[model samples]
Target: MEIKEYFHDSCVYFLNLEHRDDVLKKMSENVQEQSLVKASFGRAILDREKEFPTGLDTDHIGVALPHTDKEHVITPFIAVGVLEHPVSFQLMGGGNVEIEVDIVFMLGVTDPSAQVEVLQQLMEMIQNEELSNKLESAQTKGEVISSLQHFTSLMS
Candidate 1:
């Protein structure tokens, strides 16, 4: 309700992609067009995700947080992608755990210090199954935006 910081309307989308690369590419393109991130964002994310995964499998929903270093970002923006179907992504943990993630939160966090804060806030949302339910049930882009806005507000 408080002006919804970090949640940009242009950055939110409901995507239909069979491959994980497509999802990353879409977010990467949007970020570059919107001046949120540099052109290398897509490649960097793809490479980094291979080395250090970012998938989390919650009981309610599976999500992936794909991101790169702050140097590639021009401003802090949280891009939300609601995939039509699940796409495979490896876990950030050392083990070779693979998760089918339906939601992808591609973070273009310019500030170094805020990365942890943003992830912590997002982690809190991930910890709550109800939020995942809301996201899963959302029918429109507006509904997803509202869900994210509500989620961010509750963190304060």
Candidate 2:
């Protein structure tokens, strides 16, 4: 699938939240406001993160991929959050180890089978240091979207 289709300008954010829960809550609320997810999405994503962490330590920066089940998703989306300050999150493998994350990609996936493909695409994009750096330094929502679109076009 072309992952760029999942990005929306309204879903991009520059967050200054201090805590992980707060960051997820803000992104969840934004997607919910856009009608991308149900009201339960916020709580569901928070609970899921507690059970299964999504933090990744990339070669260039720390990233988090927090998502909930399809039941909470109204429509598919990938919400991007560039934190002003890094926030701590548990590692993906049920480790007690924590990593400070600078970026968050909160995914809303309605199709269960597509989750894997979407993740694979995201992984590819995340591995590109230039894209990650561009995302980190992006000054506006449009810039963020443009960067993602540019990267995803390369994948296509």
Candidate 3:
């Protein structure tokens, strides 16, 4: 599946939140408003994060890929959050290790098997320093979407 298809303009956000939970809650609410996920999505995602942290300490910046199981998703979507200030999140698979995250990609995938592929693509994208810089410095949602689309196009 094309990963870029999951991105929606309405799902892109410029957030100035102070904490990880707050950021997740806000992004989850937005996707819920768009009817992409069920109401249980927010709680499920939060719980999942606690169990399996998604924070990545990338080469260029700190990023987080928070997602839940397929059951909470009504439709697959990727919600991007560009934070004005860094929010601390527990490192992925690094117990008690925390990283300050600058960008967040909240994924809602309905297909269980496809989740791994989507995550792999996202992992590749996040590793690109240029794209990470563009996303972090993006002045508007359009810029963020444009960067992601361009990157995904190259992958195709």
Candidate 4:
């Protein structure tokens, strides 16, 4: 299963939101409305994120990987959101620690096993400060996808 198959130029977006819920809502709506996920997708993601945050804080960037069950997904895809201002999110596995997130990688994985591999790729991405910095600074959707091309194929 190629991970790049899950991304589309239409899935990339730039958002300006104040709260964590807004960020999740924006991305969830995009993925759902794009016909990638089911109608229940947004609600599932929001509920899941509240219980188990997927926030990650790296050296050059902070990101959240919010997702829910496979049942809520129709076609597996990813929605990229670059926030205008950093939004607060509870760090993944870091109790009581919050990070100001600049990006959000809203994952829509329909296959249960594929979830691990996707998250692995994302975790590997955060380690590369250069790549994350480029993505964070990217002004357009194409630029963001270009920055991620090293680790992900734009054409699947």
Candidate 1 lDDT for residue 21: 85
Considering only N, C-alpha and C atoms within 3 Å, which residue pairs clash in candidate 4? none
Q: How many steric clashes between backbone atoms does each model show? A: 0, 0, 0, 0
Q: Which of the two, 1 or 3, has more TM-score?
A: 3
Report the error of model 1 at residue 58, Å.
1.1
Candidate 1 residue-wise lDDT, 17-132, digit = tens = 88888889988998899988888888999998888899998888899999899878887888889888899888779479888998888888877777888888787887789888
Off by over 4 Å in 2: none
Best by TM-score: 3
Global local distance difference test of model 4: 0.85
C-alpha TM-scores of all predictions: 0.93, 0.98, 0.98, 0.93
Q: Write the per-residue lDDT of candidate 4 for residues 1-156, one digit (tens) a residue.
A: 677666677899899899999989888888777788888988999899889988998877889999899999988887889888999999999988999999899988989999999888877876788878887888988888777775675223
User: For candidate 3, what's the RMSD?
Assistant: 0.6
Task: Write the residue-wise lDDT of candidate 3 on 55-128 in tens digits.
Answer: 99997799999999999999898999999999999999999999999999999998989999999999999999
Judged by whole-model lDDT over C-alpha atoms, candidate 3 comes out at: 0.95
Error at 21, model 2, angstroms: 0.4
Position 45, candidate 2: lDDT: 95
What overall lDDT goes with each candidate model?
A: 0.83, 0.93, 0.95, 0.85
Largest lDDT belongs to which candidate? 3
TM-score, cand. 4 vs. native:
0.93
User: Where does the lowest 10-residue lDDT sum fall in candidate 2?
Assistant: 1-10
